[model samples]
Target: PSTSLLVDSMVKKGLFDRKENPRDRRSLCIRLSEEGESRFQLLYNGMKKRLDSLFGILSDQDQEDFCRIVDTLYTHVYTK
Candidate 1:
């Protein structure tokens, strides 16, 4: 789905709040609502816990290699 559609859906669900952008009158500022913030924290904590558990099984060198591989992939995908 398009970004606009996703944002609209979130807004409709009261997960996001939009307000007039002071920097740009023509555009609006979009931010997570209180509910969104709470949900995000929960999701973040859960993911962090899972990741910590998974990483705990890896050696220090393995973790370093994994991070390097992830950085390379991110750069490749995000850069033109």
Candidate 2:
């Protein structure tokens, strides 16, 4: 029911693998399964295509202005 339990179950089911981090070799690394990678890639591509179509009306300058506006809003809100 909890996240740790869910992660444990997923590990048992092999949807992810726990490996020793090569850089540290002492800490654990949660690596996605082959199936997980395939699913993730498919979902990512689908979302990206949808967003691209939605924003396609914007010119490059418009996109840049939107990003700056969003960043300013985020900074103002978060710093408040």
Among these predicted structures, which one has the highest TM-score?
A: 1
Residue 30 lDDT (model 1): 98
- For 1-80, candidate 1 gives per-residue lDDT tens digits of 59889999999999999899999999889999999999999999999999999999999999999999999999999997
How many backbone collisions does model 2 have?
0
TM-score for all predictions?
0.78, 0.69
lDDT of 2 by residue, 1-80 (tens): 59768778878877788887889976778888887787789999999999999889999999999999999999999998
How accurate locally is residue 19 in candidate 2, as Cα lDDT from 0 to 100?
84
Residue 38 of model 1, lDDT score: 95
Per-model CA lDDT versus the true structure: 0.96, 0.87
Model 2, stretches more than 4 Å misplaced? 12-14, 19-28
